[model samples]
Target: MTDGEIPVICSGKGCRAPARWRLVWNNPRIHTPDREKVWTACDEHREPLAHHLAVRSFLRRVEALD
Candidate 1:
C-alpha cells in the first residue's frame, strides 16, 4: 500500500486504530524463516502488540508504514 494509506487494524484484542507499524514475522517452528511478511499496528496499540509478539518470540522486525 502507499504511504499514509490506512493499514489493517491491529490484530490485538479490541484495538481499532489504523496501523502505523508493519511488523514482519515468521514462526520458525511452523514455517521456514524465509517465509516472512508484515502485520500492522496503530500508534496507540503498537507497543502492546509488539510486546505480545515479542513474548511469543514471533516478531522479526518492525518498521513505520509512513
Candidate 2:
C-alpha cells in the first residue's frame, strides 16, 4: 500500500488484503518430504485457507508473518 513495501497479498481468491500469516504446506504425493509450499493470508482468510489445505493433509504449519 506504499512505496518500497512489497505487498504480501492474501492467497484467498479475490482478496487483496495484506498478509499477516504464512501457511506452509506440501502435497507428499507429488512433492518430496523436504519440499514446502507457502500461502500468504490475512487474518480474515487465514482460517479458511488453512482449512482448505489442512483437509487435504497438505498443511505443515501456520506461522505469523514477520
Candidate 3:
C-alpha cells in the first residue's frame, strides 16, 4: 500500500477481503433510470453480492476490477 492508493474492499457485509470485481447497480425507485451505483466484491463474495442485488433488480453488470 502507498499514499493515495486506496485499497479495493469487498462490499459484502462484515467482510474485509480485497475486491476483485465491480458490481454495477442502481435502485431505480430511488435513482434516475440512468444513474449507476457501484459495489466492489472479492472473489469469494462476488456471486453472493451480485445475486443479492440481482434479485432486487438493482444489479446491472459485473466487471473485473480496474
On lDDT, the candidate that comes out on top is 2
- Candidate 1 is scored at a TM of 0.74
- What's the C-alpha lDDT at position 32 in model 3? 99
TM-score of each: 0.74, 0.93, 0.90
**Which rank order by lDDT, best down to worst?**
2, 3, 1
Compare candidates 1 and 3 on TM-score and give the better one: 3
- In model 2, the Cα lDDT at residue 59 comes to 99
The lDDT of model 1 is 0.80
User: What value of lDDT does candidate 2 attain over all alpha carbons?
Assistant: 0.96
* lDDT by candidate, in order shown: 0.80, 0.96, 0.94
TM-score, model 3 to reference: 0.90
Q: RMSD (Cα, Å) of candidate 2?
A: 1.6
Q: Write the per-residue lDDT of candidate 1 for residues 1-66, one digit (tens) a residue.
A: 789965578766788777778888887889787898677888877787788779999999989876
Q: What lDDT tens digits, residue by residue, belong to model 2 across residues 1-66? A: 579998899999999999999999999999999999999999999999999999999999999998
Q: Which ten residues in a row have the lowest lDDT in candidate 3?
A: 1-10
Q: What digit string (tens of lDDT, one per residue) describes model 3 on residues 1-66?
A: 579998989988999999999999999899999899999999999999999999999999999987
**lDDT at 1 for candidate 2?**
53
The residue pairs that clash in candidate 2, if any, are: none
Candidate 2's displacement at residue 8, Å, is 0.5
